[model samples]
Target chain A: MKLKELAHSRTGDKGNISNVSLIVYHLEDYERLRQAVTAERVKNHFKDIVKGEVIRYELPKMGAMNFVMQEALGGGVTRSLSLDRHGKSLSSYLLEMEISLES
Target chain B: MKAIRIGGGAGYAGDRIEPALDLMEKGNLDYIIFECLAERTIALAQKEKQKNPSKGYNPLLEYRMEKVLPLCVSKGCKVITNMGAANPVGAARAVKEMALKMGLQNLKIAAVTGDDVFLNIEQYLDSTIMETGKPLRERYPDIISANAYIGAEGIARALKEGAHIIITGRASDPSLTVAPLIHEFGWEWTDYERLGQATAAGHLLECGAQVTGGYFAEPGYKDVPELWNAGFPISEFSENGDFTVSKLDEAGGLISKATVKEQLLYEIHDPENYLTPDVVADFSQATVEEISANNIIIKGISGKQKSSYYKTSVGYQDGYIVEAEISYGGSGCMNRARLAEEIVRKRIAYTDLSYEELQTDFIGTSSLYGEQTSTNLIPEVRLRVAARCEERKEAMAIGQEVEALYTNGPAGGGGVRVHVEEVISIASILIPEANVRVDVVFEEL
Candidate 1:
């Protein structure tokens, strides 16, 4: 199943740093999210574009995780030639990640 | 005690005004705030001010004031904004003039100035840019605006001085909302916990309708109730830093846990170290409680003392940018857009004109996500070629060459359009907070 089935994400960009927050629909799904959406997985998933380190911060109480990607955005919003300078659609793109359930 | 209601009237400079006006008219708001100014806008406004002394404020100030101020005055709802842009004093005078024209009596407007540090850019000449690490002197020749993000004290002082409308320059976006909390609850400026809580509340409301549903909706999985008339966000804040975020009754938007959580993390780099001039807010320990439909209570937000340094957004002229686009349609149009993009690149290369940055992407396809996302070809796509060049001639060629694509081949091209804009790039730097002094002056009709 895609991560979109369990969570929604939001992306924001400042300078070259891109931050994406992944929030699950249910508290029961947080452990699975924590295990699936690891920083290494996210970094490897977007390895071609993300040239810097990927750091994830957990908000277990809120059932959300924030991934901060440094040196992304191709030199930030103002300098980046990308059409979507603000990275508004990155969350939707990240939602395409495949999650395997150990049932 | 009942909490005071404050509404976010405007988010960006050109944000929709009708929803905010609706909030003011029917929501029974004690105050309304507009967080309109950003980093590069101040630089652009500085250029405008240089041309005409009274033209430095946000361009939409007149229209917004005309639509909301009269009713806000009649309803006894005070207004606050950073629409002052490059000139808070000028903006205040303009607001006062508008009130007088509207025949509103005793409308007190205060402009909080002293954010502009253009003359003192010389002192920070050797200071390095926080992001690029380039020395401030490297951008000095082209530097246009240098303003420090101030705290809420100036706004609180204005309210203390009986200001009905408070205008400020380069204040933190959250400061617009947090200032009202300070004035209403009489909280000490040093109260980090309370200030942090209010700052969090402000951040939640600063983007107007975003927290309500405007930016939270998806067609199926995560849906919002009413999007067309998405209601701007309002907060009922109490003295103890407890608040309920709601909107006007029967407004078209959903205020659920999901929406609030999305907004909570909006632009937040770190939940524990959200820095502002007033305080370093920590939202990790905060809890969001949905009291009812469209009424979400947020509490337990805390923060540490503010740092001694103030963050400054230094805007400089980064040359010019040109974007030109032409679409391809009908069968195999995707191939045509790509072919057109290739032609554009060859033309730019043939001209022997170098650019600071150049990119040619096929729109209606994978423009930003690159080829990684868009694996299939579409029926129609637009070829967009853009360049950042130091010289106007080079920038002009970026579009001119694209226009020539119509005659140069890649058939079925239409809707050819080109745009050339002067670029203003911003750099962040930290300066001694003590040097940035905020003073308020009153302008009354």
Candidate 2:
């Protein structure tokens, strides 16, 4: 799977918290990943789980991707455990998704 | 709108006073903290304490503080530091000279002391031992410098006294800023949760943005930018002990989980029982995130109980050491370096002299050529021999004998430059928490 396609497949579950970011090791591969995974495709990946919109942000220098999956969880921060106890659940939730480099 | 609380650049290792000053000038910072101590510094402090009661202070600290304190006063930015190596009084006095130079009258400089145990060494050593719960035997005062690592309250007191620069003795590195939080917010010391948060914040930045990719940085060293002049870390602790770690600007440096993770492991082995004079912080209880550019928000640094003892740094005159580099110039010049090490090792071993640390390195002849006297003929090799012994007499004896190797040994060595033998002691001291205290006093020049 292409790294970008892999990124798309992994970010499917996050609902409205559409922005998914990655710290990529390879520079050219990051560019390829960015080019393959467009904002619409990223939103489409999370279409089933997300309730609202999906926005993607890129930090080109650091090879990082930020995905804003809207309504990813049930409610906003007040109703969520996003900031509690070092955000372990969030890290765990994020860790579950896997991505592979493009052939 | 709330009063703007922005000022001072962070993580400045060298004498680069511009970044922090520029930030203070532009951002209007409320505080400026500087860290400039390393492993060798402790040894230097021990040397000073031997010379005078207030000799633990670093002269560089005074030079730096002299520059910053006046600026802080002019801009109302308070300063705190652990520059009080041995003599807080002397450190304060040095700053007072700076204040006088700046013509800043009414510089209320509050000096925090009493952390030193040099005078009371015999008393503590005789009274009790933590391990055996008995008196330290014979109490042969081998101590060079003994000081308790103090917290930030003393700086808080000095701040309260309206002193601009709070010079302290050996203090928890984080306590420099933590005291300010407590003082400004009127937070109690027993506010363990908040204190823990503050301490963790200090730890994260105490080494100046090691948490944000200054040291122990992963990935390629190329991408890390502005590292030559990287900014220090500034933390904002909330009432609930939740804080954000950020630098002065959107400077380039990694602040992701990896960067934060590496820093979290620095000087910390047990996440559960991270000890400081102020509090024992649990890194496990906290979560970290690369929230934004050059910003790492550290949350939920929780600890149920505070620590019982403050980690103390004590040093004594371990001994003297000398090093001499002699070139192997004779027929077997190439092999002389190797021959020299073996000769020194044999002599010391034969004499049954116990040295603390001794090492010999062969220079000029590249080891890339492979170890042992390379048959790939080289012009000459420099046998650089260095050794440290517990006793000066013993170290000197060993030094006197190394020169004899050329005459007695198998040959090919000459041009020996015997470096001067100076009095050096391996100084180490640690004082318990109960003994050390910190106080800050602001004085006018």
Reference-based lDDT, residue B223, model 2:
47
Runs of candidate 1 exceeding 4 Å displacement? none
Estimate the TM-score for candidate 2. 0.67
Give one digit per residue, the lDDT tens place, for model 1 in B1-445.
8588999888788999999999889988999999998667888888899999998999999999999888777889999999999999999999888888888898889999888887888898888888777888888788888999998989999999999999998999999988988898888888999999999989988988889987889999878887898899998998777988998877898888889999999888889999999999998877788998889998879989999998888888888888889988998888778778877787778888889889877887778677777755577788888888998888887899888888886888998899888888888888898788789989987
Q: Per-residue alpha-carbon lDDT of model 2 for B224-266, expressed as tens digits?
A: 6666666555565665566666666645455555455445544
Per-residue lDDT of B365 in model 2: 53
Model 2 chain B: weakest 10-residue lDDT segment is: B1-10
**lDDT of every predicted structure (CA atoms):** 0.87, 0.58
TM-scores for the candidates: 0.97, 0.67
Fraction of the reference Cα-Cα interface contacts (below 8 Å) that each candidate reproduces: 0.49, 0.00
User: Highest TM-score, which number?
Assistant: 1
